[model samples]
Target chain A: MSKEWIGKTSNKVKNTVDRLLVKRFAESIGDLHPIFVDETYGEKSKYGVNIAPPTFPRVFDYGVLEGVDLPMKGLIHGEETYQYERPLLVGEEVYCYTIIQDYYERKGKSGDMGFVVIKRVGEDAKGNIIFTEIQNVIITEAVRKGINV
Target chain B: MKTMTEFKPGETLKVTLAPVSRLDLIKYAGASGDFNPIHTIDEEAKKAGLPGIIAHGMWTMGNLGKLFTPFLEKGFIKEYKVRFAGMVFLDDVLTLKAELAETSGNDLFFNVKAVKEKGQEVVKGSVHFRLYDAV
Candidate 1:
């Protein structure tokens, strides 16, 4: 039996909260919401600084797994869940830690495969949990002959 | 500011996502720890029966973030959920449309759908955002 690989990622460091980072992200994604780019416009709204979109966490959280390796092919994204404790603010230094929450294998139309769950928690400068996310990854063995797994 | 309670059901909004590239996929993979070869390697994607290197499902869902910009201070987004229905190849013009399905007090409910240029539904699901006083 192949041993299931499990591990944790290191913390990612962010020093200054650059509003431009948010703008660049929004622009790259073709987002035109004034709240994410125009600080003057955002100030007039509820959030004082430019508020990042919900998926913005994707830009910060994945850094935790900087140098890890899980050598396998044919990986599929099964699902994702994110919960926010508070809205992230600009200029707030934050860090994140990632861990393998669970792993299991089963037989399906795809074939005998394994699923790995990863969780990452984001914290503020004060060490408060601001957000948490979990990602499910499916790994399947290589198919043989013309038979599809 | 308009509260979700003010909008009726079946109201739809069209939102588009910018073009994605191989570099963007690599950047997202580094940030999300989802180094799935299908998204980063064209060869792998071809072998998997995909047109080419494709974007991540979350990356596509991230387009919905634009909709919430108009309604910030609503406590950010509380929850966003979706299911991957199809593949999004590189350089594909993607559009996300959401219909206001229901609303209660400060919370707005939406049945979200994403599609490629060919009008194929790539993802479908619901998302809920909490609204706050506009002031």
Candidate 2:
């Protein structure tokens, strides 16, 4: 029953940075830039092709953590980050996966709270990193108890 | 919001958005593939012991990028990190701000934040951008 939850990585999940996904994401955040939607403008622009927004990669599948189970409900997204080597070009293929970077518990106002730091990476076909994200989630006492963590 | 080399360390950019709505969360969920009920259904949120449906933390963080939208031609966001200080409920009007923290060659550091109408800082952190054409 030892829950050593660091460095647990997921299998790579392949995804395409398509136009529709990028457009929806751009519009959803209410930051619809021409580079994310208008093809004509994008073609004439610096990149010569439509490019996804900086934060668009948040939508890609980063696979799942193996042998770790936690309640999805009652968990708070405490912090998040996105570090990009470059923006993912539209229609480009990316492989993503997640790693449990660290896990610990702390005393909070409501009681015991658990902090889970997960690092998700997106790489190109050559295995070069395009971006990496570290997501910090706050799990409630009940969630910790449920998982016996 | 100065472009190119005109940006200085103390320069700042601000964008005040409309109130957060149920549809905003719903749209964000669909676009981001995060279907957690606590973000969309009020009943589900109550069952989860929340006041009501809360906005996804990423939703608010994503909107913070708006402060740099006009300056894209000059650079791109190389890093964005933030802590969710408070929950975002419906009808919360968020004010996004970015102040150039420093400059190093082509890289520009910015202290970014989002504040609720009531003056609560919901999200706060820094962003790093690399200019395409730098001096």
Candidate 3:
């Protein structure tokens, strides 16, 4: 993995937080939290409406970066972390983008592997950051082997 | 499940999810844009020396993340972090247990973990969140 990819930014993705989409995201995780599901419960709560889960941004479709491309076939999600400025509320349109934060290689018990650290940020219409996620992925030769197998 | 007002320091909450199935893996693949064969194709996984289709680490992390949902308001989580402690295979039943680590005025912190049958730990981390006053 070339560290040159570090600092490369991906295309931006925009989305309006739809209640149904939030519901679907929660359903996918089998989490039926009242604030994410029950409208009446939401009305009585602080936000006064449904909200998406912290990890819901995982569903945002961020197409591949223009100049930074890693082997897509054999990538493994190694670790993930998230920090939030505020909750992603239902009905607020959000814009998100990703950057290759860092890159490196290490030899592990499995074999030689490449690591790519990606930082994804989401901001509201006014440009106030709503959340940020840092995801690290590992690329292995076995990924290519599995494809041919 | 513990509420912001009701949760006391040192208390533990347990959340058990539905078994991780092939369908769940597929849906997650579609939803997360992580279509790695290791999570969806059995032959590829076996070729890679995996038992079969293994669940995504993020899926297990998401399972652990859900435990804090009921206790705090939306977007109140200041920070969340998790490490992939182990692999989860198809049909593995995951149990998540979270314990309150500390609490301040309106901030709540918890230590959470996900485990499979026989107490094999899969994921473990801490979540720091802020509580909002209910009107």
Candidate 4:
């Protein structure tokens, strides 16, 4: 079936890199890279500023609806792809808009399920596109007894 | 014994992951839209059989970016893949170590592993990066 959902989130005014936030994000992922925390080390890098790690964008909660509700269970992460228009620098206010780009139903080995594609675009203060992330999530009903998909 | 090939395995790099807090996990949930209670709510996580709110797999993968930046200057990571193994509990220290696996032409590949304080491997994966010469 051809179905699509679209949603938008406004810009968030962030004056700095939010060390505590970035640090926590890094820590959760078991990251030990000093550039994320050491300002001096980051300053010497090619970016000349504390650059948020590549997956840093995933930390923003834009609240996009992809025809699904919050706390979606049994949601398996199928694939993820990222495209960067420009490098992200610290202390820049940014915003992201998420949309349900596409969806389809398929018959798997177990049974039938649906696949959803979510797209999120992050933009800077000047409305320049910084990056775009596309994630595919598979939604299926929990097995009645002892089947796995 | 010298092998026929001219490839050499790069040095190994180790990084220690510090303890993670609950607040940190919440932020990651927001940023990633992965509101799986197993990662955000401790009570639910415990009920679900996980020791505590576990970190997102992608978040762990992101850490590798720092390791590669020094080698591939002005290089954008074209792709990365990882396979999840064990669970990561809150406040548990983790470690990520990598060794140059091999090189194909100008592409550099590294085999990386993430483990917990107990020495349990949480994830094992490989990353490929494209290198560009300075202008």
Q: Interface RMSD value for candidate 1, one decimal?
A: 3.0
Docking class of 2: medium
Clash pairs, model 4 backbone: A58-B31, A59-B31, A60-B31
Docking class of 4: acceptable
After superposition, candidate 4 runs with Cα above 4 Å error: A1-17, A66-71, A143-149, B1-35, B40-55, B63-66, B69-78, B81-132
Which structure among the candidates has the greatest DockQ? 2
- lDDT tens digits, residue span A58-136, model 3: 8775556886656655577778899998888888889888899988878888877777899998888788888989988
TM-score of chain A in every predicted structure: 0.78, 0.94, 0.88, 0.77
Q: lDDT by residue for model 1 over A18-134, one digit each (tens)?
A: 576666666645565787777787778666676776777766644545444545555677777777776777656678778777767788886687677888778876888887888
Answer with 3 or 4, whichever has the higher DockQ. Answer: 3
The order of the candidates by lDDT, greatest first, is: 2, 3, 1, 4
Better of 1 and 2 by TM-score: 2
Q: Score the docking of each candidate (DockQ).
A: 0.43, 0.79, 0.65, 0.27
Instruction: List each model's interface RMSD.
Output: 3.0, 1.1, 1.5, 3.8
- Kindly list the per-residue Cα lDDT of model 4 for residues A33-125, writing each as its tens digit: 666656787789766766666677776755545434523455566666666654556666777667777777788886776677778777776
True interface contacts retained by model 4 = 0.30
Error of 4 at B67 (Å): 3.9
Q: TM-score for candidate 2, please give it.
A: 0.96
Q: How do the residues B1-135 of candidate 4 rate in per-residue lDDT, one tens digit apiece?
A: 222133368757778866867766676676555677888887887876666778776766676455654443345454455566666677877788877787776565777777888788876766665555422
Best candidate according to lDDT: 2
How many clashes in each candidate? 3, 0, 1, 3
Which regions of candidate 2 are displaced past 4 Å? Answer: A1-3
CAPRI verdict (incorrect, acceptable, medium, high) for model 1: acceptable
